[model samples]
Target: MTGILRLLTARRGAGRLHWTDWATYAYLGLAVLLMFGPVLWLVLSSFKTPAALLEFPPSFLPMTQKEVRVEGYPQPLPLFSVTMEDGSTRELAQVRRVGLIAQMVDPKAPGTTVRVAADKRQPVREMAFAVSNYTEPLAKYDFLRFLENSLFVTLIATAITLVINSMAAYALSIYEFKGKTLAMLAVIGTLMIPITIVLVPVYLVVTEMGLVNSLWAVILPGAATPTGVFLLRQYMLTIPRDLIEAARMDKASEWRIYARIVMPLSAPALAVLTIFSIMWRWNDFLWPLAVLTKSEVQTLQIGLNAFQGELQTQWHYLLAMTVVTLTPVAIVFAFLQRFIATGIANTGMK
Candidate 1:
């Protein structure tokens, strides 16, 4: 019994590390890298120049261009630096290339051209940022207008969603009525049907109502999502029926009870739905594309499509605009993430 108690109570030395601990930490490190690696790359790549972007092995950092003088060359050559054979570095300019060997010009002297190894010259690049990537797109493309459109749509849709879904949930959860179970089941049934199945019909309805090309076409259809109704209903079910009864005993109107008592208690769930609604409205591309014909009224996601043309894509500008588009979503998630945890924990309690 003493031996068993000793074994059970034994603690490892503070300095001693276990293999399991190491493995757990390694796994966590890898998980974090996997999750955040692309995001880090995206942010860094947004600052890279077009030449740096096109380099064979991609550079992780942003770079700037510099002009260097070659003795025989009529004009200064655009040269980047590279580490050479003896671990020394040289500034080499790309002139032209044959199948394998690249014709490089030494910018330091005129009439100095050499056949350097192909793809071997790294541009003598300094850490550079092209603010123009963001500025030009915003100024030329009217990205601010699209951003405003997205914000307006997201806020209005989210507010309407919360009010309508909460009301539906309150009615279903608290009130005793005939066919209540069937009604709840019907709400859940909508979940099985993919939104794609209803896309054409919804669009047709919007067109018939003459709401095509209007932001309302986007906002009105999704104002009361079945998923929101289900989430709030599940949460509202956890609220005590007695409190609602007590409110009723005070002769409180149903709307008064819901607005004052239920909405306050269900705040966590509301926050979760708010985040979801924002993401939905912000990232929605296809429907907005179909409904919104004019560029002035489009969302940020639609505006981003302008960066791609028939012949070429402006990846730098696209990436910078992408970063701008993501900022608001990140801010919203950061602020409300705590509520998500609270909602899940409280919902699980009942």
Candidate 2:
């Protein structure tokens, strides 16, 4: 790992770079842009005001029109740089707009007004972030409640998924049952079935169980994912059977063996599953949307969806809320990603 980091970050000696090296750097740069450019845009746009968001020629940075207080005006007037007829420019404050013409006043001489073509004037703008875009929604909406619900659902569901999937994987990998092959095949076969097909049946079952409008409605239905089971079972198969035999010879109980021996050794695979489960539960919308109908039970994603109205959508608030929602998932991935490649690459070995 240290060698890999050194190769990645080390400076080159005094030599011309090879064509392949240039090509590799270009590919890496493009890949990084493709992966993170939109995310960076989203974060930056979250800071923009509503008017800035609606601007035709979008800017990379958050900016707002500069305003100045004029003597006669009751409110601050928007400042503009007006181009004069003889190719001169002056800073003026816009009082009003009448079709193609704009009523402007010089900040120094507020008593006099000048009429200029609106096209000839450009609004003075400065880098400004609309923090209210984030603050207003958190204040007006039940943001904390929704965040709590989302956290509860993600954490509980992920825990349940890990426990259930790991146990299933343990059974399938270690035990010598009569129909073990058929059971493994059946587990793998579920992967071919799309979640859409199962939605109605799952909802019906949850309704029958009186879990609708409850967090469990979303959590329980997806607790045992086939992908988790398959990945874990493949990884568990690589564990030496002699370990289990030695534990048995030492009079270790099955539960003790599973808890102490199997689980610790499967940490990398479990970490991989934990990350997958967190992402799945955190970003899940359709299942929760179908299950959680009440405002009290809604997750952050559903709450964010509420910003859309029949006629107009609150893009500014929505973007800000999206950034807030993505933060926890990003943190989880950052911490657990070290085990991902190792878990995946070694799953099929031996």
Candidate 3:
């Protein structure tokens, strides 16, 4: 009994030490910084002012440094105005105010000037916290409409993609038929074809179908992803043939077996496909940009274009809007991180 307990304890301690090794900690630390570093900068910069934004070597937090302090009373600066000499009119001449030490010295009272200098340092401009920085100019853009359109397209694309790709994948995975290899070869062959080469053709097809500048143009193009079909088919092929046969013997139709048995079993691969679909659709800028011409119809990716002018770009407003635009995708990815994990775990089971 004593020998067995010692062996078990040694094994457990060895396992613990292995997992907590320096290499493991190093990898973990690098992974965390890669994932969260940019996000930290974005959240911190969102609350900063325009001056502080451009301030070199930047302060990450809001400016709390005081710039100006008043002792007795708030002295408002005088506004100078000039008048024409043609009418022999007198006018206030423009001049920069001198430092407090020089003003107090007054040539006649140089003694008091030293005392005044000792009493006060130049006032620093009070640190201005512009909450409006994060709020104001950001309100000027039409992100709500962009967000709505993006949501509509992403949801529709994901659902339709899952359905269509799963059906195609199921057919490719289970059934043995003539021309099967030929069909798959053709499918895979198209993967190598550059989308740019097909751009004009796709545009014409949409134009012929009267889908120009419509939501359908964006949603429908991505509904049938070749990669999703391929990934799902490969994963589904790993399902045991006996399970599928048993389902059919129990009076289950192929579609029902697919829905009830195959889909549930293929969750990891499906998850992988789902992540890819969401990311691709979400990041789909070019196609949506090509399809959507009106600002009202534009997607989130194109919202950045709204603030950009031919000669100038609004950096501060652009940064604020970019932070907002990135937020939802980040949230979605965070929630779906499990899907990516499973996808990686079960990538090549077959």
* Best model number under TM-score: 2
Which stretches of candidate 2 lie above 4 Å from their native place? 1-5, 8-14
The model with the greatest lDDT is: 2
Model 3, 245-302: lDDT tens digits are 9988999998799889999998877777777777788778888888889888888888
lDDT of 1 by residue, 1-350 (tens): 69767644444555666776677667867998999999999999998877777876787888666766666657766675656678787778867678877777766553667777766676566788877888998899999999999999999999999999999999998999999999999998998998889999999999999998899999999898988898888899999999999999999999899999999999999998899899999999989998999987899999999999999999999999999989999999999998998876665533
TM-score of 1: 0.85
TM-score of 2: 0.95
Query: Which tens-of-lDDT digit does each residue in 296-324 have in candidate 2?
Result: 99999999999999999999999999999
Candidates 2 and 3, the one with greater lDDT: 2
Residue 234 displacement in candidate 1 (angstroms): 0.5
Candidate 3 weakest ten by summed lDDT: 101-110
Candidate 1 yields a Cα-based lDDT of 0.86
lDDT of each: 0.86, 0.93, 0.70
Error of 3 at 298 (Å): 0.5
